[model samples]
Target: MRRSPDLHLPQATRASAGNLPAFLAACAVAVPVLLAVSAGNIADPIVRYDDYPALLAQPEGFWQKTLTEGRWLNYLWHLRGVVTPAWLNFVLFQILWGVTAAAIAAAAIPPGNRKWFAAVLALTLLPAPPVFLMAPWSSTLIPGFAVLALFAGLALVLSQRALRLLLPVFTLLAFTAYTTFPLILLAVCLISTRQRSLPDLAGLLVLFGASFAGAVLAVYALNWQVHGVFGIPLDPARSPDPAQDLAELWSHLPLLQETLSVLLGKLSFQSTPVLLFHLGLLIAATAVLLRRQPLEALYLWTALWAGMALMTLQVLKLGVTIPVRAFHFTWILYAVLIVRAAQELSRSPGLPGRLARNAVLLVALSYLVQTAVQFTRFRDWQHETRAMAAAISAQPGPVYATGSILDHPAARKAGLHRASSLELLTGLQLSQCGAVPEACAHLPPRLSSPAPEPQPQARLERFEGANVLVFPPRQ
Candidate 1:
């Protein structure tokens, strides 16, 4: 009886068998801590943002409203009615994100590249994109789902029997779940097509096109079902011009550049040592790619360009400041490129290989330290928010809260600003905190006079038969 080829270990990867115990131990220790860190404010009864409360407020047929609003059929939205506890949502979100990241690492990285896999996993836990830790929104998890769907679809296309049958169903669900799925699928298919047979590659390409078309049709059907068949607009209102939009995007490029710099610890928050560690890893990766698979590196560069163009178009159309969460796909691509480069470098003999291994170690260490700092800050914010919510809940009569508590140095360093952070903390169903005017249009009139200055402490006041709580900027 012969075993399947897929089950057989490659000669290069056989050495990793010795490290399996170490990898498993690291995962066992790290995954729970990551979950705990991400679950910072989950225990707070107050909901975070508009969508959750809005959905909860709907009387019946809430799914219709959600569908009409052009929110992709995200799994989280459907769970609104079923999942009662606000914290449960965050817990499920962290778990799903963890599973998706692990699956992608397993599928994308070769067995011989176990060290890169570990590094990718560690980076996945880090708070480079602050929204993943600070906001309990489903959009933060979309990229993780996109990665899972892409890898699973690739397996299906490559004629893996079990995945071939399973992934088409998964693809349909994934495509409907996130608007970003199409762009991610395009990038993944383009990058994964190398070294495959021509016939199989052609089949994969066809599958990609078909899946995209199917996604479009599904969205239309959902819209038509909610609104009437005639309600579906064939041509939506067009933007002023692509040239104008591109110019606007160019003006905002500096903000995006600064964000990238911060993520790499190159600028702001003063983490120069961490920046140097990242530089070492990137330089080693580039050296390995140039020495070995230059053409593959070229393809990766092209994919990066395509991904960035798609993301920029989205930003321009929305006219909102770019959120760090939007860079999720870009991070996934970078991880894949680095892991491939590391694999090639690992096979090198002598000092180059040793240096490459050390670079990986340093990169992992830097991320771990950075993540620890971020977790502490997030936990502090969570505690403050919980206390504020409790105070608000204890007050009687119509309650109105003013000002923002997220003006703390740690929140600013984590890329959260006054407006966005306020939105996340206010407008809860359980608490007396009324929605800020900017978040929801319908709110009880304010009964308290505006403070002489934004308060520096969270305090409750009584005015005009209403409870007014003013949360001051964190001092």
Candidate 2:
């Protein structure tokens, strides 16, 4: 394949004001602070449906689960939840976010082209994802490996020789946690596409594959010794018919389109103007970048296709519902592509450049406020849920739990749902009275007639529009 014309990527576009410190510091500080505000609820959420037997599981039982579950590094972070309060263990995630942001800043800002705007541009619109911060479910919080891969990949591009040797070791650490499938692939695709030469891209791809395989083998060996399992659990058990999910691409094209549309529509962070602004920025960036620099725009297009291919493969392999987390990195990648566009436009030699630069900065600051206002609704859900849980725990026997806290109008307005009795009352020492079939039956008195018995143990309370049966606390 012939090479496209040179890109004004960081290596090519860095101008010498020698102003690295300011941009680096801004990203390092800004991303984390924004993250803290958007997701800084340090309260213990009721354990999720899938996450049950986690907080309730004693410290001793968790390690066994970690082995089969895969994602050891992730589980190691989870180790805190079982040992102490899940809330406290969650603070460790904040530290992880900090380290991730700082590390990415180090990788993206340096020797950056386009004056020092790369730092600011790296986080152009939405910075940290709110889901990772809410920490409601660890399943969706795989940002750790993704970010680490990004840093490692970018560092390799910086010619960090040590990483070439260390990438797999680190990839092992990440892979052992989340099945290095996406992270390794992302890193390789990211670095390789940034390359100016085909040979370099091929070499990097080989290195990524080899390092990742080494990590996978190492994990399999460890599991073999510990659990007598000979196989690595890399997502869905690979089937004989790789195309089983689709069976035939032509027939399933409609399904794929519908799936994509739903994913875009269900982005929790989208609230009116927020969605509009996101789309506007993307369209504007793609148009500007494609016109101004088609070859570089090809890089974004290639990366996007690679991301979608991974997501499609995952959905096909899993043979089930669409995982929202599949969209997580792709969403971030969209922001990144737009950020790169804004940065490139900022280097133009005319009034249009000035407008592009200023407009992008305004977009950045605008989203900063939007993030705090929009995504911060998570805290409200937690607060309301806590009050309801406290009410339920205070009641006596056979309190009918409709799982109503989340069903209330206030919750739906906030883009929150799914407050399972099993999940919401676990740490509260309360039982669902059979309202939730799977809810703990420690207090097993089913409401005979959808009404709590009139006694000191029962107090009927109301939340939003839902009737909440409160039981007096167990003595």
Candidate with top TM-score is 2
Q: Please give the lDDT score at residue 52 for candidate 2.
A: 43
Error of 1 at 97 (Å): 1.8
Candidate 2 local lDDT, 1-475, one digit each (tens): 8764444445423322223453356456555765554464455442444444344443443465446545556555555543446564455544454444434333433243533454455444234443343355543244454545355335524443434556666667766555523453443345324333556545655676687668767877877887788654433432212344345544445556666767665553545666686677778888887887665566556656655775576445543345454455555556555666666665657876676667667766665665556545555555655666666556544334533444444455455434453344524434353355454333233322233333223335543433445433223
TM-score of 1: 0.68
State residue 345's C-alpha deviation in candidate 1, in Å.
2.0
TM-score, one value per model: 0.68, 0.68
Give per-residue CA lDDT, model 1, range 193-220, as digits (tens): 4453446545654665576557657667
Error of 2 at 381 (Å): 4.2
